[model samples]
Target: MKKLHLACLFLGTLILAAACKRDTDFNYYYYEPADFALLSQYLNLPDRPENYQSTLPKHLQSLGLAARPVDYDKATLGRVLFYDKNLSKDGTISCASCHKQELAFSDDKKVSAGVFGLTGDRNSIALGSVLSFSAYYGTDLFGPSGVPFFWDNRANTAAEQNLASMTNPNEMGMSHTDIVNAVQTQPYYEPLFRMAFGSNQVTQARVSEAIAEFVNGIGSYKSKFDSEAEKTLGYNTYSNLERNNFSGFSAAENRGKLIYLDNCASCHSPLQGRPEKMKANNGLDAATVDAGVGGVTNQANDMAQFKVPTLRNIELTGPYMHDGRFATLEEVVEHYSTGIQNHPNLSPELKYGYQPKKLNFSAQDKSDLVAFLKTLTDQELRTDKRYANPFK
Candidate 1:
């Protein structure tokens, strides 16, 4: 009986190993598109009706960050729409044109160019950290305390934001009718729409919702910082040994982490919704030409205030700030350290009354901060086949 049981166990292990290998092999081949009809098989697609939760880092989970469940069919439809240049009126550019997957869904350009070489006034915010953003949305980062979307706080929701960009003259250059007409002309959208919505018909709302679903699915939780922080008592309460002997961080990086917690965490807290909810006037200018949040509210107090973006993947998403004024993290650190201007509406966190307060970080401190920031980059996100271009 013992011998028979051992033989059965060995066979079960072999079967499991073979199944894992087959799944791995399938993923490698599934990405190679031969025809549109293959999409019907749902190869390489996430399983349906299974609530797909974003894989948040342990630290975030400890902080009570939670992601909404995503429907695989909806997200798949969104993937198709995200890569389809046909969504644009001229059929030359897609949403992927500005939000490239390689760069953490942010353009490397200071200001991204739109359809027909037209340019926007502000830098494109990275959409890759969608899990964090989604979890914190409708909290302080978006409502009651924070302005909703864009550098200027122009749109309220991701759906509204997408529609705005799609219709903007400088962006995809399409009207509502244009978008519907464009999608209607594409035969591929019929099957995708059917799969997502249980119907072949496409609507403007459906298009926006599908794209937003895809954007929400983009998330990063596999960074070096995430791995190290998971082993410790989160980012705020690292013990000496945990700080000094973190798996992949250097001494300088560890020191920088302490500095960030002390000086930056009020606005960029890893656990709280503070990072997304708070907007600050980092004293960019004494009197700013661009109003930022003030532009949307037309309030003097809100002037020069922009949403504080998440620091995750901050290394890849540059040039930094609303206008992409600073080209490097060094420059950004320097600005906070010594270059803060005394703007009337400058965030109190960065000022004493009306006077801008300098952090007075040394040169080495700046380098260390930049080093630590780079640790936030998620290598897996850069190459994740789930978020890659699917139109090929």
Candidate 2:
């Protein structure tokens, strides 16, 4: 009996030591108890702003689009995956490596450096800079039309985009099988996968879906522009933009708004109105060096055309344009003001009689335009703990 009791005690000690080892292995990062709770607060939010429906123009009211919902548990898991550099082949890059939170989830580099020090061809597009991802890509913001991901509009869904980035040689540089192995090898992910999918089994599909859910949960609606827009109910039509002066804005900001409404809003869209055009050749280059959408579709009409991303948080997200060519907002405005090159596929809005149309913006016009653009900056999104890095 004495020998049996000693044997049992020895086995218990081994088990305890093994449990401690497992805990220490996963302790490289710490996730709080509160962080583990789904809360169901940040994710699963409405696609549009509260007053969005009430302020829609009569013509736009009949779209009959429903908001897409996000899963909180999945998003929580995604937050971990986004920051985990182990997802990369060399264990040096993650989704957050390219898309940083401080710069509105955009990289400040002209072209982001990926795993193995390879440089990407284009700028890192900002995520969650404008409306919620659901509204921006879902039925409402684009007016019942699905918005494709990436500058070239190659991927139709967020999952596809995430997978593409993971597999891209210049990005994560991980195969689907490699990605699965990486996640499975991590000691911390067992509980995360169980919490997210009710199973500890990790898969590429689940990883992409969870990351998309987390991304879709991110939003930037608490800006000065949103505040003023709410107070004024809404600015539904392009015609009324100049007529209404936001009570909260300074004269310079209001002046800039007029300039933006007249020149920029046709594509960017103020408030929540549908942009007149989604993709356009903004005359970045005279000749097709990159070919942009044309490269993806092999269609001549799509040449030099790129996704016209929303200008929200334009202050933080720079250098501007798909190639990150322009270093400052003034440079961007100057492009439209005097530097629009006559690309063959130039959008009609930028062309007058086929020659590059110059706005001839005065110094005051340029300054005010920058001022109005700054109003779109949302401090909440930049500092929100919910969307912050879960690993400490």
Candidate 3:
């Protein structure tokens, strides 16, 4: 009887070892020792998110905002999901397909291409073109405190926005069940889901939440403007003061700063990098080709009103506007300087006596404005490994 018991224990140990070996073999094909090490760090325990108070310039820190607590493991899982083409119906498109990192997470095309080569109705909005995503959307949950998302302000949160993108027939073309099945079928995602959620179970809600957390981590603050602004945080009082030229700027750039402050700063705040109004009709068309916010709200007054985007990384994100009408900075400047049409629902700031007001900028003014706009580009964000595709 003692010998029989000992034999049974030995057999059980052998089976357990075999199962562990098989699991290791499955992952070894894709993950190297180094890759597993990276994965383990992200999985076993998550590092704290970057400290905004230390990372951000004091000028931005003064905005009375704090970073919301996010699970780093979940965000890492979200990063993989963001770049995974398997999320799409045909396995060709990913979140990264339309929103490229080099272009400040925006697309060069007027409208992004979707699954089956179908075109989207609107341009891909730049995700990281703010000091932090929290600053633009606010730390509040779905409520009056934060701005709604998309050009039309239709979605309330990043999760909602991602869900819309995934289900859109022309976009990812995945239903909730399809998305879950796709994620479950991927062997790589097994450990990712396990690490992120403490189990290898994939759910639609988990997928959306993880992607949302990853996107919320996206931010661009290390620009030429930030470098210059950091030096003056002690006394310059950037938002309230009569803006002065930065010591680091060239004469043309300084001139451009003045033009931006005097003419453009009312809409696009210089220091804060947030627009005064969340949505406005920028006089893109004399008549509303797309009803814009009105289409979402079913309100007459909201017609043609679109979300005013932050100008961070404006240098890289081009073929600008919701429709991608303007191709160059010069053309964009010229539009604001002279091309604003007398639309019925044009913002009050753009109207003078109920007509679109032209700035009458000279060639030099336009050139300088473009120069100043270039300063807003955050070079670090263009190639940050944290935001890059993890699938290799």
Number of the top candidate by lDDT? Answer: 3
At residue 9, candidate 2 shows an lDDT of 100
- Relative to the true structure, candidate 1 reaches a TM of 0.83
In model 3, what lDDT does residue 366 have? Answer: 93
Model 1 stretches with alpha carbons more than 4 Å out: 1-52, 130-133, 138-147, 234-247, 271-277
Q: On lDDT, who's better, 1 or 2?
A: 2
For residues 193-284, write the lDDT of model 3, one tens digit per residue: 77678888899999998998888788788888887876755344545543666888888988998898888878777674557678898888
List the candidates ranked by lDDT, beginning with the highest: 3, 2, 1
Find the 10 residues in a row with the least total lDDT in model 3.
Answer: 45-54
**Candidate models: Cα lDDT each:** 0.75, 0.77, 0.80
Q: Which pairs clash in model 3?
A: none
lDDT (10s digit) by residue, model 2, range 83-187 = 889889888999998888889999999999889999889999998554666556632235336577889888777788889999999999999999999989876
Q: Which candidate ranks first by TM-score, i.e. highest?
A: 3
lDDT (C-alpha) at residue 255 in model 3: 93
Per-residue alpha-carbon lDDT of candidate 1 for residues 144-209, written as tens digits (9 for 90 to 100): 543367876667777788899898889889999988888888766776787779887889999998
For candidate 1, give the lDDT of residue 1.
100
Q: Please, what is the TM-score per model? A: 0.83, 0.82, 0.85
